[model samples]
Target chain A: MSCRIGMDVGGTNVVTGLFDSEGRLLRRSKVRTIKLSSCELIQQLAGQCKEILAAEGVRESELEAVGIGLPGFIQSESGVVSSANLPFNDVPVATRLQQLLGVPVAVENDVKMVVYGEYLHGAGKGYSHVLGLTIGTGMASAWVSDGRLHEGAGGLAGEIGHISFPDISYMCGCGMKGCLETVASTAGIARQARDGLKAGWVGLLAERFPPEIRDELTSHDVWQAYLDGDAFAGQVFQRTANWLSRVLVPSIALLSPDVIIVGGGVAAAGDIFFDSLRSYVSASLHPLYRERLRIVPPSLGDDGGLYGSAEFALKSRKIGLRI
Target chain B: MSCRIGMDVGGTNVVTGLFDSEGRLLRRSKVRTIKLSSCELIQQLAGQCKEILAAEGVRESELEAVGIGLPGFIQSESGVVSSANLPFNDVPVATRLQQLLGVPVAVENDVKMVVYGEYLHGAGKGYSHVLGLTIGTGMASAWVSDGRLHEGAGGLAGEIGHISFPDISYMCGCGMKGCLETVASTAGIARQARDGLKAGWVGLLAERFPPEIRDELTSHDVWQAYLDGDAFAGQVFQRTANWLSRVLVPSIALLSPDVIIVGGGVAAAGDIFFDSLRSYVSASLHPLYRERLRIVPPSLGDDGGLYGSAEFALKSRKIGLRI
Candidate 1:
């Protein structure tokens, strides 16, 4: 049985997994994503592939293909694009990997890969039309209809985070003011918490976080405070939910997907985030749609991206071999 | 050469067209859509089909199939569903039409048909991922990706009009408060103008439309006053554009279509409506997407729905014959 290597490349770490044709994860490895040149990063990734193969006692010839998922605007056809956080721009990722590994390689946006992974093997398994939202440091979404990803005209589809929230005035990293990301993301939550504290808004946060640590309060801290029943934290969380619902409601209206799978750190807050969100979404949805729509958390959790990359590689290899 | 019949059934009219295999309209006919029973509406549509066929001198034997586009939540496979504006609920449109016309019948949502028409023969011809927005009495949108319509799980997709706008408090016809339709549709615009007039907000509307006519002022009157350089009318139009941009900017970020095709009576206001809308949408978009996206008017105008219905019939017929 042929195996493939799937890699999820992020700003902080590179996660690689080995899986067989049926998408069973045989082995896995990870390495820190150091600030290196594009060529160096590619070399490190190839080295990790070799290390995994050696650990598994498999030869390069026995592998079918490799797939990589990373952050960026991906030109899927050429497997090249640029991202602000990455070390390189216009990097031909698939070509470079194929040259080094002597196998076909597939590359796609990381979030899209995660969505594909969920669609193939996780919560989205049985749904033909799936919408996946990942809310972490930033927000991103991907759409899969009829079992294929809708990458859009420029492969920039599903950038839900950058949607302008005309009511807000926060400047976003994407150079736009009042983007949904500024108000709905993990970073956004943390920023709001910090600003509220600075403004002398009294809440349970004062008791939960002392003076020294208060300055470094993150979204996790805010979430913990909310869990501890802090009114301010609860309000912040509610605002995020409101912003998310504003975008999600319209999205549901526009896409009408069978399932909406939400993942990432914020979703890990569990019922604290989802319960109210589900109610808000359901209450706001048209009667015709509210009863049938499913909003749930991703089952695969963090590994979804890796599994998706592997599945994509296997699918692409099969097609390549068929051709 | 085989011909086909296509029908666009709306709340006010039933338009029928005869088209050859190439999607060219050979002949057309229309009849007023009185508030008939479902059976009567079906009979009227069937009668119009026969009238068009006779006018074109095309025999039923030479026709491939018939396609109908109407407003409703469609179960495309069964071609049965309900809509708020339609006189009947759970109407078996295709089954009834097939029985009456003695031919294969395919039915779909009217907006989806218009998008398909635009995709096939209008301004959306060259784009693989197309988004069509029709702003008339209400707002609706449809998406075409990879040459196929993305009909969501329940065919309730593209109902952007019902998306809640939390910032607004206006009640919508859909039994929801602050839906986008309350602020962005033709009715929404008219309501805002009427409300502003009632609130005694002084504007050129008072002069353009005296007290008697003020009570009957429509969206067209608002548009006319805006064109005639009324500040309040312009602000009203700008507010509508703002609300539209709020929804559309996010849609652009999420869908990233090649072009956004705007149609319907509101769009017929020409550059008076589009120029400002285009500027607002552009100014609000992330730089990554703003440069590549095009928002333009539909080339086929009102006939887009008819052509789309006809084209859908031809395509469905070919597939049916293949099966």
Candidate 2:
């Protein structure tokens, strides 16, 4: 049976999965992502791919093309020009993987892959126009307009976190201030809570929540508090939702996708985030799209990148032809 | 010679043009918008298409397709479901126009169509990433990601104006407070200057500009006064650009297009707006994308939208096309 391997390169781990033509996960594995040089990281990734194939009793020659999903920008023709959260730079990942593994490989933005995977299988299933979003340590989205990944010029489309905001209250890791990422992502949640604590606003967070919540609250904790009815915590999520809506409105007004597939750890806050966001955007959208908008949670979750890479590899290689 | 007709449906007029495959506008004509009911407007738009094609000596059978670019969200499949500016209410503009013209027709969000046009031709030419913007009585943008139109799921992708802000001094047509359209648009400039004047701030606008500019100074007049070294006028444009930047930061950060095509009556203000705004965004972009951002003027002038609508039609028809 022909199979494809998918590699999702991230800050803390490299997740690789084998998928069949049907997008079924044949097997999957992960590896630690130490602060290695880009060269070393590439070598390690190649080695890991080989090891996984061996352990699964699959021959090296049995593999098909590989697809890599990156967390940041990928220039046209050049695989990955740069990524912020990960220490990647001018890395020709696709070419390198092709040379190392002796197989064809495709490198795409991770969010795009996720959006594509979701469209083919997960939350976006049955929708022709789907939007895949991953809002965690940072916020990124992929636009699948008319059943295709919307890669902006030079493969840098769907970089939604950099959309500007109303203030310079927070600094985005992308080097800009007041990016949606600085306020609505998990990083933003922690920043907001920390700023609140520093400003002497007390909440049940001190007693009911742990160090994770007090030190750096994720979107999940904030949502939990909102569900628990803590005013400060609830307001934080509410404000974040409004901020998200602010960023979403202009995009929605302009693009008008068929479905919004929200992913990332922050999205795990579930209905707390999606519900408020849906209502806020609905009530606030142009009458052209008020009721037409559907705020959906991505079903693929954390493994979406892995799934996306596999599907992309299989589709590009055709017939799931293995190496 | 293969040809297609593009129609820009505005509240005041329905402009139509005939173009060859090279995107050359061979002929142009227009008709006043019909005040008939919503269904009648669709028919009127169809009539305009017929008139334009008939005048151009192009038989309906000779045309490949017709493209209608309107001012709102176009549900995928259900043509022209809603528009805040136009009178069409869930009007099947594509089917009606196709039936009337005896050819295939595609209807898209007018703003998206313009951006698509520019991406393929005018300002967006030679670049993979380009943002097409139009600022008039209202503001809108078409986000072209990697040569594809970005329609978010539910077909509500590029709502750039509806992005929210704090301390909203303007009311947006989208029914949202603090939307970017409320402030950065020429309408916004007029409202701000007029309201500022009402609040008793003094300036040279009282004696120099017309009702639109003097009574409610636009970015155009503000820049003129600033050129004359009026600090107050400079302040107004600066504030206006600041809001534009504020909305732009997160929006652009998320999807860092290499070029932000700023057009419209407001953008006509020239350096008075771009100079300060560019500097601000440069100082504020997230580090991830700060190095790749550029704010440039729209290459396509008044005709950009007409051309963009043609682009939408070409892509929809899936014919080997050029900008």
Candidate 3:
């Protein structure tokens, strides 16, 4: 009879879902995320939680817990520390939501949530050590060891985006030069394409978008061109895969995780991108480690984060009782 | 007197020490390690263990366990799987040692042992997460999270040496091109010195070791020349630090460990090398992560792996009991 509600608050959208103890989705809701004040965002999320619970014929008293996943720097005890994309800064999200719903609440980083969800129910299921990489507006990753998220000393583990690449000249939003995200994320891909076109590197993009509109070129366009057999577009994707292999090789060598589950907007590019990436990563890895390492797409997709939030809430509730 | 014997089996030497529960070193012994068959190596290690225990006036009945730290891929339950530097391949190290000593035996990768030793009693003491990097003849690393070694699925985690560096063309011993170790380890530094001198690049090394003996130049020679104000030597060391920083920046971003402790032969170059490395890594790290991250030297020196082996044996005994 126990049910829980999970929410994924992203830069573009906020998704909430109600699930039974067995992980069955009972009800769900979505809303466009706006640049609102901390209090406003909290109120909006709380309202949606109530709506989902009511739609599922569940009451606040009967709810087990509410878990939320948000993008940004987070301290589990204090909530959102700071988010580059979200307006929440130093907000106590879990406490605020708990007060509103009269139930236990847990707040975790969005990527970590997705990793935990995958570890428990998605691609990472059955793995002792799971590594999750999400490449979108930025490149980020999370680590799960023995079914527990391996949050480093500063609660800042898995900030893979800030890894420096001296050969790269692009500056990252994190105020660093040549960060992995500056060359590997969706934003990075588009930037690379734009720079290539501006430098007289002829390609399908150049023909499709004139010089004036080239700046508006997106990763989607680059993918389409690559699929259409444009040599330049193929180079861009190949370079991306190589850059990713550079980072992943070390990660695989260091962590030796059972499985590496890749997610996010960019990962939706599917087999075309992953087939090349898997081969590159395998070929580049140490022979001893190459045998067991598997890199695959996330099966839960966007809902992975929501499911992770629910899993987080359930696990946190169990830990709270033991305490 | 629950005494334990800890043995560190490196490519060049074997060091064995006897310690009490307080982790106090009571007796120690050392022997040169040659390229011997797995059986010969095991016999040598057992002989040294007996020598140390007898010298400490400890009887077999008084011994709690035996722990060994060796260079290779280790499956703790089964012992050495494969060692790139050592002669152990699919060798049952723990069982052999246990049979020889008639006590519980736990075997772990040498780097992992050093990390555990540092985490429990050395520079990494009081930290929740610790990362250890050893740059000797080759580069390697180990990670300790929440007081446990974060061994990846295949017990091949912490193999940072194999991370590929596309820009550099140096071939690594691991049969990979452009690995971090190809440009950052002691051998790498010596190679760089040799290559620089061969190209008619002037340095203190050229003056000290004539053209004929230039090939005999070692990393120590490079360090000495750098101290003597040789520009080529300085560049080699600078480039080495830069490569270390490149690998470290990503590791720091991903793990966010409380401390990063650098050890091994190359690290013996001392403050002249570490000072520059600390500054470069600090500057390259994200602002949020840079504040709390610490990069420091290993305090246990050569004794770290031995202490780590002792710690491992003790902990394994406790776990075995629970099971």
Q: Tell me the interface RMSD of every candidate, in Å.
A: 1.3, 3.5, 1.5
DockQ pick, better of 2 and 3: 3
Q: What is the C-alpha lDDT of each candidate?
A: 0.83, 0.72, 0.83
Tell me the tens digit of each residue's lDDT in model 1 across B1-323. Answer: 78888788889888888898777888878889877888888888888888888888878788778888888778877888687877768877888888888788889889889989999899999788899988877788999888788778866789888877657899887788888888787888888998898888676787766667777888889888888888888888777776777668778878899999988767777776787788888887788788897889999867898889887877776677211
Over B182-242, each residue of candidate 3 has an lDDT whose tens digit, in order, gives 8888989998888888888865788987778977889999999988889888788777877
lDDT of 1 by residue, A1-323 (tens): 77898899999899999987677898888889878889999999899898998899988788888888898888877788687778869988888888998888898889999999999899999998999998887799999889787788778898888877568889998888988889788888888888788788687887666667877888888888888888898878777877788778878888899999988877777786788788789877787789888989998867889999888877777766211
> Which ranges of candidate 3 are over 4 A from the true structure?
A201-203, A321-323, B33-37, B84-87, B321-323
Model 2 residue A267 distance off true place after TM-score fit, in angstroms? 3.1
Better of 1 and 2 by TM-score: 1
Best-fitting candidate, scored by DockQ: 1
lDDT tens digits, residues A183-261, model 3?
8889888998999898888767889978889888999898898888788877777788778876677788878889999
- Each model's TM-score for chain A is 0.95, 0.90, 0.96
* Model 2 error, position B116 (Å): 3.3
- Estimate the lDDT of model 3: 0.83
Q: Deviation in angstroms for B147 in model 3?
A: 0.9
Tell me the tens digit of each residue's lDDT in model 2 across A118-211. Answer: 8888888887777667788878777765655666544556667776555646656655556777887887886786676567666675456555
